[model samples]
Target: MRVQNLVVGFGPQNDTDPVLNGVSFEVAPGECLALVGESGSGKSVTARSLLGLAGDNAWVRADELSLAGNDVRGLSEQSWRRRRGRDVGLVLQDALVSLDPLRPVGREIADSLRLHTRLGAAARHARVLEVLARVGLSDAGNSVRKRAGELSGGQRQRALIAAAIALDPPLLIADEPTTALDVTVQAQILELLTGLKRAGTGILLISHDLAVVGRIADRIAVLSEGRIVEQGPAHAILTRPEHPVTRQMLAAIPVDKPRGLRLSPRAAAPVSPAAAPFLALSDRADPVAPRNTVLEATGLVKRFTRPDGTEQLAVDGVSFRLERGTTLGIVGESGSGKTTTARLALALTRPDAGEVRVLGQPFSAASEKERRLLRPRLGAVYQDALSSFDPRLSVEQVLRDAVGGGRTGRGAASASAATAATAATAATAATASAADRLRVLALLDAVGLPQGLLGRRPLSLSGGQRQRVSIARALASGPQILICDEPVSSLDVTVQAQVLDLLDELQRNLGLSLLFISHDLGVIQHVSDQVAVMLDGRIVETGATARVFAAPEHPYTQTLLGAVPRIRF
Candidate 1:
């Protein structure tokens, strides 16, 4: 397959600003060509054009475009459909959103076979099992019958890969396949892709993660804006990058970086000494003495019954304490009980056993009334900020509700009100209106978003902007404890760095405690004051960030650290 001088644009207005500017690349049989770039760099757009999936408004032009010796430049929609799965396959990043949630995963795989092959239902089922096994999802007889939601993150990703490669297409396009997966699972997925390449499949890998791509890519192309800034052997580009954008990306990596230092491209200032007290060691001899523990979980255990009527332990005997103005990062693989433990900490789920204490008060066992009284002191940021908000609410309305000045389309207002300890202490009507408006704008400024966005809805915001708004919303209540769940997993590398820096800054300036959860160890190492390694529903290791990282005591912890991608600088 080859694409030379390829260019694409969306509408009449986009003609002058094409997404791809004369991009050119090639993929030989049994070789992997990695298209590396930040978000909106035209990597995905270039890949989609080859499959004729660039959408109707896309104006695609190229001096030469061919796939498997056939001209793909002017293929009709019908021709593209016939060639898509049979000639080429695509694996998207998010498996949960990519696969059918309602149908059994096996059936979804079978649909592709039915469309491209003459196999019967029985044969298709056998083929589905074959591909599922090929992708390392060989559970049991009924494994393929499980819905997408029923599978773990890794398993769901494997299912999507199986569906893509069911017929063993000649060319495969995998876009950020390991972005959200844990290190071990990410390694496994990359190994699977490696095996596919070895078997003589031409693969196009698109990603912002240079380390992951460096592991297997035979050739590399660095993209910035709408053009390929650098292209060469993987070793040449990674070791001695010539382009400034490429150098910026390499420098932004969290590996080997000191704790509390900003990882973003923007100018960074040292954490303020006047910030709230932290239990972590620091040079400041007179830093404020330790304050009371803000959150504590003791022997937390949570259980759920699966659809098969079998018991499943999501979290087991997990214990951790978070001090005032510090970050405790929880790192683990998918289905390792990270999210379950987070839910228990948030008091969103009552543990079957054990308990949680918030601000030195019993929280897990707290009644609805008591929980409401304590709500205002806690806030959360999720991985998907757009989904976290109501699409109908504009940014100003969202902030107003969060500030407890007006009714929110979602429960932002009620939640804020519930968290506030006293209605009497709440601002008066006139003062509330003025103060809330000012506070909303202040929050926006603090998050690095312009006040002009106040009139726009979430759908109109970019991913980075939406995440900033989510952080702003979480801050509106002035919560002492903030919980972040895979908050930066889906962001581009540069954006991820920016958000991490922002969170670190916020923690310092506000003296807020953070419960940061993620699968990326590098990210954990960058922002955490302390680290807790969780596996199979237990904390395998816990200590100060520097201590635990310097010499990991647990096997799981060591293995996780080993799997983190690093350049040989």
Candidate 2:
């Protein structure tokens, strides 16, 4: 398991130099070698080049690249396929997309075994179950036939790990494997990986999270702009870093401290006090609408039955709402009905019992078609935008599709065209100049993204860049209310602050209402007008954001707030 003089990237496009220069690295048996860098620094390209899977568009070159002493640069596709699962296992960033949507997760794991082993069907099944149990996916025996879509994010990640290690590969390459998970689940995945390392499986870990890497890696390589700036023991690199980039990263991590809120993490690097606040919820000069009687619910219930004959109540008699143009932040652990409540408001899902209304309209009862008509009234943004965007479509197409530019034929063009012509006669909304280009520019600028990135596809952008595009797209509809489901969960702290500030600006300038959902209590406190603490599918405490923080009325809220790791100076 070693590589030297390994390099990979796209060829010259209109005369630009190589995307990845001659990058080199190595990983020894039973050791964890970490590669750290920002997006497009060739972190993923180097990873893909190891298995000869970088694709036709990429030009791969290496002097000596060996996986178990077998030269990778010369290996044919059929030959590399044999080495991939058998000698070098890979767990990608997105477990959901990495796994086959058409196949059962268990069978995906089973397929790994069948490809590399001569074992019989029964033996293979037993082996797959064994690996799944090792990864702590309980009831592996029963979950063997479950489709990838049916599993949770953490569960899907566990399944991916199970598949990667099914053949007991000596080397494992994990690229941001825990990026999409909650902190607790992240700890669990780290524990499992560390346990495997102890049992003689060397790992090549790739991550943007320094803390996570600090906890797991024995050695670290700090990469900036596709170059390894520093390489040494993890402790030495972290506590006694010798590079400016490394120090810049350390400054970005949240440290426990006492302060009202220092510089907003939105700055590209550390900024002086003049920098903006992280997510200024107080941007509105006017007071929020009266706290009580603004939004309320009673006896709300939602339930689902699993394919394994297990019943799960996603939301049970839960009741909560928001003040007009004010943020009501919902804090809950995963599977605690946070997403369900958002869906109910957007009319994406129908509840079992209880009424849901937006400023007092029968929201939950609206038909899906009617809901689309009302869609412009309510906007949304999710945690992972790559999953939401069609990878095949360019970013321009995604926003254009959302803005009602391409659906004219199906929308009774003759009748709609007349209506548009009539309205255009009055305001010229349908005139040749009425295209949404200004709207697109305004939205992109609002989210702090340059207009130059508009032509690129979602796949070509960084995670943070992709998120900005999603925010711009959500606002493209110009909804009165926006529902954000952990929108910054996948971002670095610095990027997170930028997004939060952008949301704050939108709320202030456009008077947009926000239903902000997150597990981070600090974010909730900083941005929420009112806070609703949910636990086990119920809102245990609901009140003014400051009041709730000053004196949380519920034990669960107390516990959740207490668990928030404070920043140290």
Task: Report, for every candidate in turn, its global Cα lDDT versus the true structure.
Answer: 0.85, 0.74
lDDT of 2 by residue, 1-569 (tens): 77666666676544556666767778888899989876556778778888788877777777778877776677788888888888989999888899998898888998878888999999998998899999999899877888888888888999999999998899999999877575556767888899989989999999876767877788999887777889999889888889877776665553332122432445322212222221122222324324333345557788889878898898888877666678888988788899998777666778898877654555677766654555565678998889999887777667666655455222123445566566656355344224555555556666777778878889999888898888777876666668899998778655665567667766766667788998767667877878888888988898988788878879877776654543221
Off by over 4 Å in 2: 12-16, 69-71, 101-107, 118-122, 240-244, 247-294, 304-312, 321-326, 357-378, 384-441, 451-466, 473-480, 490-494, 505-513, 519-536, 540-569
Tell me how far the alpha carbon of residue 109 in candidate 1 is from the true structure, in angstroms, after superposition.
Answer: 3.6
lDDT score for residue 489 of model 1 = 89
Off by over 4 Å in 1: 13-16, 110-127, 267-292, 405-428
For candidate 2, the 10 contiguous residues with the lowest summed lDDT are: 270-279
Best by lDDT: 1
